[model samples]
Target: MESPPADTAPQTPALTYRAPTEEDHARVLAVLDRWWDGLGGDDGARQRAGLLPRLFFQHFTDTSVVVERDGHLVAFLIGFLSQSRPEEAYIHFVGVDPALHGHGLGGELYRRFFDTVRAHGRTIVRAITSETNTGSRAFHARMGFTEAEQSFPGYDGPGTTRVTFVRELEP
Candidate 1:
């Protein structure tokens, strides 16, 4: 079997971002699983999946986003526009394939999500992560989010303190 020349081989499409859809649930979960798997064991990965419930994609599809390359899920951000605060959008979960870390895929997903919510008149963006998650804290900081004035402790569950971050969007 002869291989095609490098230049003649099929070229993967550039990373693309899009709103989530009902049909993307399984692949999204698989990506999450792969992401969590890199951090630890299966148990932790399963727990992480819970953070990305189907309802987010099914109902808040517009605010949520999925990034793909050659039709493979590479990253995603699950968020929604706030009903109580029409000017706000809340990002509940975000994940990037570990192998692609340092490549800025995570940042791209966030920027896309920001542009989307901002287009809908949302002027504020919020997200939360455990206080222990320094990686997340640093990433949020780099993305221009600041610690909320009144960050709540144990926001996730018992003994699970959280750091709340917010970003003010420009019109």
Candidate 2:
């Protein structure tokens, strides 16, 4: 029997997907540093280098995933596997080069992330963002993440009023 007509749609160029190696740290940090430099206050800056890693980073390997298209870096999602449960991932950072922000690279990165975690038997994914980062909060919401927690501790920085989000994908 003749097979159904092959899909005529053109394939999107394969996104080069991989973990951020030590070599990628410079490029990734370059993007992050620029983003941080654009911030307008001293509060959040103070929290980043000193307070964050002790409270964040350090434990997650491949915590940063980069997406390269056309041999050029376009986007990244930085996070790590978690220990709270046998199957969970904590997303610490996700950044789309400003030039590519609205072009769906971020979403694609997230899709890859979920698939990677699911393949490893992970059941849930979690992330954090600042309360006033309306743009990011909205994006997470559209991605089907809901408000799991929100905190405002009267700290000196912008993200002191932080919002946490979570998505549970399985039992």
Of the candidates shown, which would achieve the greatest lDDT relative to the real structure? Answer: 1
Model 1 residue 84 distance off true place after TM-score fit, in angstroms: 0.7
Per-residue accuracy of model 1 over 28-101 as CA lDDT, tens digit each = 87776557555435545755777777787689887788888888888888888899999999999988878788
Q: Which lDDT tens digits does candidate 2 get at residues 13-91?
A: 6768777665665566555545555453655554543433422323444545778877766776777677667878877
Using TM-score, give the best candidate's number: 1
CA shift at 77, candidate 2, in angstroms? Answer: 1.2
Give the 10-residue window scoring lowest on summed lDDT in candidate 1: 37-46
Cα lDDT, model 1, residue 160: 51
Global Cα RMSD, each model: 4.0, 6.3
- TM-score for each predicted model, relative to the true structure: 0.83, 0.73
